[model samples]
Target: MHDPAPMPEVQNDEEVPLLGAQRLGFSAGSQRLIRDIDLTIRAGSRTVIMGANGSGKSLLLRLLHGLIPPTEGHVEWCERPLDTAARNEQAMVFQRPVMMRRSVAANLRFALSARGIRGAERAAREAEAIASARLEHLVNRPARVLSGGEQQRLAMARALACAPRLLFLDEPTASLDPASTHAIEQIIDQAHDDGVTIVLVTHDAGQARRMGQDLVFLDAGRIVETGPVAQVLDAPSSAAAQAWLGGRLYLDPTHSSQT
Candidate 1:
């Protein structure tokens, strides 16, 4: 992986879209998982993706983050093709974050080292990440031995330590306690305040309202609605979105849901 370039200074123009997908799609053999998705994510914006169990939320997030190749269409970063340099500027945290057998501090150091950060700069970043995630007490503990919440926190801190310009999280707070969830959200909030663009996938309506400025609702591999968080959650126009926000199950007659 190439060393990530320094994040560009935020321009005054918020209208310029930072990332985009044109007719994005993914499939497993004959089954189409994600259908044609056309979306734009503005720089420094907080966008949330919400959907039912098999609504292709996580798959879409993976496509946008370039973790897996799409079967069709393309993703763009800063008006250019999504390439290694663009991916270097992005990071992702999964629902169940994988941790090294090494200590918490070691895990963080490894990530920074991979980014070519070293010596005093690396030390500074490590210290900041430890503090930011409040992992000082557990720094010496084996990362894999930490509680679910601690491991998740470490995963988030490790990602942030690399100074990614775009952060993608897939149900980061799922299965975590309220307190732990709040802690993670606070860290995400801080990152956003520091000009990191956030793209999150979540099933929690409350979390969506708390962390999202823009909302995208997907169902049966297709986007049903896209709008401001409040507008979409409070007054969703699409039948699929309405059923989801209304706490009812929505099954698309035309498409089979992917699990």
Candidate 2:
């Protein structure tokens, strides 16, 4: 696919919301998977979304990233409607990333190429991404043959290769070992330091605290609480937040409370 036409850059003011969703909702058949989510992602913030297994954390992420249209409301980027031009500035890494049937270096090349980069610039980005992900030794190996952690690292490298302004991750380290998880977090940290806005979804509380500046807690497809990571995790005021933090099963009052 060809790259979308370039969009004029937004000013670098940190206070400006880079992305926003107003009353966002998503439904499948008779069930509303996401409900009335009003969210703003600052230009240089690390926002983490956390919730139970069926709380719609992933769904919310998808909506915010414009991977799927919301059933109600809309998403905006840089105060404009979210469209192809806006989405071109974003990238997402999924739980089980799909690698192309090609070599590690080839995958990185493809990503940069897709962004309309070429020649020396593309080569530099490929090298930098490979080095950042510590995949230099495996550059010649087929991406699909790499281990789970290696593949995830490559996925991150591929996403970052495009130099996106916003990065979305959904359980990128859910099945990795501690070392792999740490590596992934380091990449995320580096990306944030480079002014890339981060929005991640993870069930690991410790990971949330380590990577998040702000937290969004979801319960029953709705936002229950949002605040600084420390406050939300330590002194959560909402019952849903409290229950999830305390290891108790959170039963949304609207649903059955009895087991």
Candidate 3:
């Protein structure tokens, strides 16, 4: 097939409707993973979604990314429905890096190619991504054989190579060492600076404090509270949020500070 044409650019900051979810919910059989999640990711906002392990943080990210369909309600970007065109302008990194059975450099090249990038431009992007991830020495190494931290960095760089306008990360540094975590954080910061809107899901309070401009706290599949990071993290109006920040995990709403 011939090269895919470029997607029309979002005209301006205002044109970027960002991400919006209305009455979003997801259920498997009789159990609901997420419910009534009404949220909006603003243009260029470093929004962090925080909750306990089973609070559906990862599921929520997948729902918004359109990787999974919501059992109820809808998701939108740039005021348009979440469809192929919208998804094409975004990228996602999961908690566990999923690498192809190929060299690190080759993996990045594939990601770029999928986005219709080729020729000298593709090589340039692949080179820059490799350098950014500090994987110059591992260029020809098989991706799946890299150390855990190295694989995660390669995953991040691959997503960045797509030149996405929106980025969704589901605890990308969850199991990484402090140094590796810091490197990923720096890459995220640079992506935001380069005009990528970020939505991150993490349980690490320290990460939230360092990168969150806004916070959305979830408990038992519901948003307990949301506001500027300082307000929500420091002075949460919801007792459930306070307790979670205090290291208390409650899967049952009745067990939460707020009923």
Candidate 4:
């Protein structure tokens, strides 16, 4: 974890690719958003995607998770195609988290019940998730009535309830205060220790350094560089990545910062 290498040290686990996107591309009404990408995500490593606005980072993540079909190429999870059943082992948390109109505990229950869990087992799971996110006192409060930071924590707890083998985080801490962000970072570290493959899309350099060993750098709908975090952030191989990592490539700074 100290070295920011592109490929994590291979583990003793069996040969199984957690995620693979080959020659992936996406288009909408003659506008291509992402193009000709190939990526393979291994288990037990945190691979972060970093780039400027319109660099196709978010779009590429969605494609890899099988939320949207690629106009070209395909995605695979664990040797199988990225179908619904295959995707169930993975979970994603978006930048602006949306919660139900119900109580915080109710939201957790709904997520667990979706995976066919119910009753006392489900209630215990909800309590544990809330405590993990430091929201135990807010369990009975309405989800929507909570503060912005609280809502994001709930989104995180909900994602953890499923115990996914792979987790996709798209700016999960984008709108949070420092305390909230730090709390979620600890939770993610815990999840990583529990053997969940983590793919995070973020622009914060420090966050990248902490969580990312390998990096996926995208620009203008194409992957500009794919390698170790040190190479991509410290000594970026591509001009776009270098400028981005150095904080000098923004066309408009406001659009680039998550906050």
Candidate 1 structure, TM-score to reference: 0.93
**TM-score between model 2 and native:** 0.92
lDDT of 3 at 84: 92
In model 1, the clashing pairs are: none
Q: Indicate the residue-level lDDT of 64 in model 4.
A: 90
Q: Tell me how candidate 4 scores on lDDT.
A: 0.82
- Candidate 1 segments whose C-alpha is farther than 4 A from its true place: 1-13, 256-259
Give the C-alpha lDDT of model 1: 0.88
Off by over 4 Å in 3: 1-16, 251-259
lDDT of 1 by residue, 1-259 (tens): 1122122222224877888888889989878889778888888888999888988999999899898899989999998999988998999999999999899999999999998999999999999999999999999999999999999999999999999999999999998999999999999999999999999999999999999988888877877777788988998777888888788887766555443
Write candidate 4's Cα lDDT for 105-155 as tens digits.
999999999999998899888888999889978989999999988898899
For each candidate, what is the lDDT? 0.88, 0.88, 0.84, 0.82
Better of 1 and 4 by TM-score: 1
**Candidate 2: 10-residue stretch with minimal lDDT:** 1-10
lDDT digits (tens) for residues 44-69 of candidate 3: 77888888778889888999999999
Per-candidate TM-scores read 0.93, 0.92, 0.90, 0.89
lDDT of 2: 0.88
Backbone N/Cα/C clashes per model: 0, 0, 0, 1
Clashing pairs in model 3? none
* Model 1 / residue 175 / CA error / Å: 1.0
